[model samples]
Target: MGKLASECETERARTLTKEGISMDSEKVIKRDNEYVLHTYNRNPIALEKGHGLYAEGPEGQKYLDFTSGIGVNSLGYCDLTWAEAVSEQAHKLQHTSNLYYTAPCGKLAKKLCKRTGMNKVFFGNSGAEANEGAIKAARKYSFDHYGKGRDVVITLVNSFHGRTIATLTATGQEVFHNYFGPFNEGFVYTTAGDIEGLRELVDRHTCAIMLELIQGEGGVMALDPEYVQAVRALCDEKDLVLIVDEVQTGVGRTGTFLCCEHYNLKPDIVTLAKGLGGGLPIGAVLLNEKTAEGMGPGSHGSTFGGNPVVCAGANVVVDRMDQSFLANVSERAVQLRAGLAKLPMVKNLSGIGLMVGIEFFGGIQAADVLAACREKGLLVLTAKSRLRLLPPLTLTAHDVEKALGILNEVLTEMEQKAPKEQA
Candidate 1:
């Protein structure tokens, strides 16, 4: 039952065994509940260690990691090179406030700019901060040029930007709007793939348009390619800033170094986080020449942003995402999608590259599927009405096959039990 639910989470705290064993998982979860904020409904297992695409519980039970820490561990769990880079940087000089320059920051900035054709970079601590910086830059650019009338940014309905008040406001979903009062204003929403509705939203007051090439948390939905091209054209015609929130889809998660690469879009600004730091905390806003200078000194800053250790890990990640690596990601995506399409309960698949969504048509809940998978030594994620898979980029061939096999077994079990469940 540990697989089906938080089977082991409710037990009292544990102590050392007769042979002098260390503290087990239950104690940690118990302590966490007592001290930590109740924001997350965390899973039961106390994952103590990880390597490659596998994580081990407190009792040393290994599980295949398909969620990849929600698309943040691009190199999977504790890759050797990434760990070495981070460790070396930490020893060298871990923290130097952004007031002064550092080698790692400049190196990462150049790599990102050269790879993505973005001219400038702003560092932040998370996706929300990155998006906030972008929003500010867009509005500032508008104010600097046109002045006083244009400040609105149009994002797609159901699209997710971040968790901050400004980003929550920028997000087009109404559900996230509750309880967060008086969110930073100047954001509007429109239906995905609807050009006419977009036109109606864009008046003289519009400053920019934000897009998530593949809307990750909003049920893994992707915008139509033709529609994206149309949006790019419209932005060009109107001189509107185009911002792509690639927090989940960037850093080679979508089979390309950046999701915009798949669309051949050189957006005015692109925000990145998640996989960029492998497993460390980091975020960046990549800006093009047209908008690079949009933000000047004294405008924005973060204390721990661009930490040397994080940038070191990020540099390693970026270096490994060359042409050959991204090509392999595309190939793996094809393999996984093909396998998923043949599953008994999967009605369809949405998203691209390693970022995928399995839409079930047999009335099976995505949350149930996720729990069942976890119980069966496989970890997965859920987004809205679908099961989202954000496997690590460095996932091996054996792990992929193992994940698909477990998924098939789960689908079969669900289908077999569906009739009884209804009865």
Candidate 2:
């Protein structure tokens, strides 16, 4: 036999090592800390590469990734099709200013509008930019139709919009408001699901109501469907633009093209990022008929917006969001939710589809759980105090079983260490 399979694999790895394809984890981490900004409290491990649902450390340690690069790797790591599309477009053309049109960009926009039933699409580089565009569009539409002074937009308290000055100001968390002084005006915050309170907040100054259908960073909390319907009705009654920020919940992240599908409502504007471009940087604002004319030339733009390479990658991702793919996503979500619910430490679960949040009882610290999971070859994330899991939608049943087993072991060990009364 031509060398055993394991031997061949070992030989390939050895060759790669000799060629210096991987480096010392400590050295890489040290270099990164020296050069990179200190904004993120990064994990100790230095990831080298990844394939499918797992990423490998520099030292050959493998990790089952539940975070999916914070929900950007919708197709998991290094998907061949996505990579090929990006590479092909890179060889052909990469970046072009919005002054000219490209086939990839136009095709991707058409696909997005077709899938989401939106009238127009504006591409950008990230969720924040998309939201910024949506905000501008809403304000402009209000100014054109209802005249000035109606520029205020109401966002939900506890919502996390983005990191830019405008988006940060729009974020409802008071904790994020520190040191950002005299933040952008015209943004108001209200409790999520309190339609009456939301109504009370709206006035002649209110132009739009923006929210995340599933608050991914705010503890993976899915807004109540009835409340969402009420909000839509209120928007219609008040003639205010409805903006849905699906940055984390869009592009099959929640087992649907958009989470708004689950709620049976289409808002006037939708902001998308994260999973939209698979692993690439891409953001989009989807406009409905009512707000299709909200933006005009010189109103808003991005230099790298609709970059051909990014659009090529996004085309593959969005094209795959068909009925069959989305159905599988839904099935996987059910499997994951059922498995997570069986854990003894899980107090409750929130979220729909692959977007999950596990609230633990017995005073279990989510940070401790995250660290333990990391040590045990699993990568997870935290939203507020809850353990958030946003695994790749393509994760198989076997992957779900394995992940749950690892999580169960971790939680069981933690439970055993808890005080008897608390346990």
Candidate 3:
């Protein structure tokens, strides 16, 4: 009976693979279109397997990955240490209700607090959830101490917060605000790095000012250091909570454990996700002493917030992001930017550390550059008018050279195809 059952499972797996009904990108897209809501404009390629900075598509074509699953795979795909830790923890204990304390979760929280100097940590399932927790904590802190009528949160224009109702409202982009009407109130928007604009908008009713240190989706724009410092001072004087949304820029993406370290500013609240779980889903909100006590028991909860398996993976990820590892990230960023700048199609480069954006000149659209790069066996991302690159932190010098070579070839082809100027 056991042999028969094992044979049955093997046959099922074989059948799925043979029929391409498994995780094939095309098949998955077809199934998703038939049964799932279409929200993303997905690329044509279907990813199947990965190792370090390389991924294989369903067709078995190898591509050098510069997306890193949109900045979620910090250590690259299928990292041995991370996989082993997750597998071991999964066998021992996958999950338990938040009512019961899990050692892995506690250990992860302690590591985060100790490394970041934050007073407390609240776990969740994604970047959006972490930001949501931060928002709730900020509002509750204001309500408990300063009384009612001060619940407004000031987010910068072009900032991408999340898709949840409250976070959607908190998001500053006008495009996301649509189709979700009668939205949550008390969320306001301000221009990025505009000190006067921020001062004008932040009133007694404003309880918190949330921002991304480097707006990832907003064209990879970095906030001015002086402006950040000014906002920190204002938050302190006005008793307002300063929340840093480090969803994409955190976890050594910007050559630091937290992007705030680059500015040397300590925010009232810091939210993390993306690379925290090493490709597994996890998010956290770190709070200082003043706001840490604001969230009491029964105030907030999540069922799978800090699952043991996810925390175990996160522990491994955190352990790998040492000082030497982060310095290499900076060094790679320099190499990537210098290579991109040499391309004739490249107009300007933006962003810091590994999160980079290449702007094309001669009226070439970002979409064009992305499509060209994709066709050349190089996976890349785009933000507005710039070609974005978020390669794995573990990407070697050889992989970088190969990607750059492909990019150069594509850009040259594009230039050759262009029409000459009219005399």
lDDT of each: 0.89, 0.91, 0.89
| Model 3: how far residue 331 lies from native, Å | 0.8
Candidate 1 lDDT by residue in tens digits, 355-411 = 999898757999999999999999999999999999999876677789999999999
Steric collisions counted per model: 1, 0, 0
lDDT of candidate 3 over 61-143, digit per residue (tens): 88888999999999998888888788788878998889898999999999999999999999999999999999999999999
Please tell me which predicted candidate would have the highest lDDT against the true structure.
Answer: 2
**Native-referenced Cα lDDT, model 2:** 0.91
Model 1: residues with Cα > 4 Å off, grouped in runs: 1-21, 420-423
Give the alpha carbon lDDT tens digit for every residue of 215-294 in model 2.
Answer: 98889999999999999999999999999999999999989898999999889999999998899898999998878785
TM-score of each: 0.94, 0.95, 0.94
Name the lDDT value of residue 140 in candidate 3: 97
In Å, residue 211's CA in model 2 sits off its true spot by 1.0
Candidate 1 TM-score, true structure as reference: 0.94
RMSD of each: 5.7, 3.7, 3.3
Provide the lDDT at 247 for model 3: 93
